[model samples]
Target: MTADIAADILVIGAGIAGASLAAELAPHARVVLIEAEDMPGYHSTGRSAAFWHETLGGPLVQPLTRASYPVLEAGGFLKPRASLEVAEINGLPLLDKLASEFAGTGVGLARLDHDGIRQWVPRARPILVGGMLESTGADIDVAGLHGSVLAAFRRAGGMLETGRRIDRVERIDGVWHVQAGDWHTSAPIIVNAAGAWADGLAAMAGAKPLGIQPMRRTIAQVRVTTDDVPDHLPLVIDIAGSYYFRPEGPNRLWLCPHDETPVEAGDAAPEEIDVAIAIDRFETVTDWKVAAVERKWAGLRSFAPDRLPVYGFDPVVDGFFWFAGQGGIGIQTAPAAAMLGAALLLGQPMPDAVAAIDPAPYAPDRFVALAQR
Candidate 1:
């Protein structure tokens, strides 16, 4: 049997974006959040590496990351795990460029000599010793952050429904009538936060399409004895990002090739070839051996053509909003992104920085611009 519900704000996906926005909007409006899976965050959100990094991307995304850092720090969502980048001797040039580009963003990394590197990770291979950059990076508590948002939404009288796959959508009398299987729902504003399925969800709502694609990123776990490894060592990434390894538990390390393979929506599995490539890359840069394997998994990182997040209303659709295509930075940038989303939904003025950086660049309208010309 299908149920019917009405709300002032209807959020289609319950990942970081939808959940956070629901929490933010619930205070001022009746909010409803629905997740297709039996639970929220069952896809990309569940598979995140959970790190607070500000200087990892281009200049455009830096402010959002910086703006988000304060909240994460204040709310106790971050742990000072620190971060480092090491490469073979030939990789020094790229490492230097990275440091120069991101110097002012508070990462404050410096080149480490061979002796300095030894002080951090003694097991690092000497022959591959190009140099390293050590910075005060934070380890994020993803579950705690997401849960906090959920709790906030619930306390504000927000409603959430799970396992409701939206099958159809229609606008009637200037309101959205949505059907998820037999259940019918209505809302004055419908937010499309469907992650990898954002574009498809927009189409279902009769809104202008945004070209969003889902890219798969695979990660693996390798077992090692902790006797020789320093407990305080930061996460070590390759200069080229060919692969990276960070201490996980007392006796294991988490590794990834940082691959980006395009895929369809759903739970993603690690490719054997990707694992093999990661193993080769990890072994090449570090002294660690891949003798024992603890486990492995993969998740999809959705992206727009421009690789920036798409937020704001569909220029062609009255109340349909776009809030997907976060790539892999959803967890880190959710605070600011969700604020911008709620602002757009409520027809309120955006923050000065958000206004300065025109949301049109990342809007669903860009797809129409491409076709218009």
Candidate 2:
């Protein structure tokens, strides 16, 4: 709104990543957030069954998750729910590797023997040899967190454009022109935060695609035969990544077969076969019967080739910024990621929250470098 310092930035994708960064940069710039969906966060953000665990996104993303805890916790968007990864006798070595993988990363991982894990999962099948517990893990309130960021963007005088899929994007006369339909906007910079559709969005801008692939993950909310399903059932995952389940409520649980099927970018629906697979995997672990499947849904988790988030300006595109490929941990790591992103994009020093993290590993140029080699 300043004539002396004219600025305009268009962020494409009003999900957690774009919303949070747009909010962060709004006070310093004129920010417009564009969403293809009618409502913001309607796609991947609303569908996430996410949790805050240092171990979830693997070692490379742990720092962001750890640093983001203060912000998420201060906002009261997390609940205490531990995550336990159990292994059968043959899978104990995998469990040990999990323990050693994060040996000194400051993430707390307590090795659990059969009896130790039994205390957390009393009805676990007896084939288990041991497990590891991430006591610091907690359930992330995805909706609350996404809404909060969107609210922050609005409060900071940022604009939100919805229901507009990008029909055309071109950089002309040193300005980028983007249009969803009859409406369009031009700015010096454009940020691609389009979640599952990121690679497609990049192509629209004449930017090289980073191989951001969308993979479908399925979930089923099932009613159990057991009369009293404890509210404290921790999120239990298989060491081999075969399946996972946790209580959605008393007598109701969300079961997943840990299936990550490759798919094209779009709205994802849970397949009936996947639901059956989840139930079959669930039965293999416990005596609790799934009395009924109350609900089922699927969401896309997009990832770069290396599975790390892409968070820098394109090495080739003049004004296109890459902020996609966050996978399933985007919500949990939003605060720190936004901090790092806004700082990098604005040419400012990173805030104390993310200063310890080096930004080179996540740069979009890494892919180009790989291609050159």
Q: Which candidate leads the pack in TM-score?
A: 2
Error in Å for residue 165 of model 2: 1.0
Predicted candidate 2 versus true structure: per-residue lDDT over 203-236, tens digit per residue: 9999989999999999999998876667677899
Residue range 1-373, candidate 1, lDDT tens digits? 1228888989999988899989989998998998999989988888888777766655667677767777788889998876777777788897788777877766667788667777777777675565555565788899889999999999999999999998888888878988877888898799999999998988888875667899889888887644455677788777776777788776677889989898888789999899889888877666767767778899889998888888888888888988999998889888877777787788788865455545565667777777799
Question: After best superposition, candidate 2 residue 201: deviation in angstroms?
Answer: 0.8
Best by lDDT: 2
**Residue-pair clashes, model 2:** 0
Off by over 4 Å in 1: 1-3, 113-115, 127-134, 351-361, 366-373
How big is the positional error of residue 285 in model 1, measured in Å on the Cα after superposition? 1.0
Worst 10 residues of 2 by lDDT: 1-10
Clashing pairs in 1: none
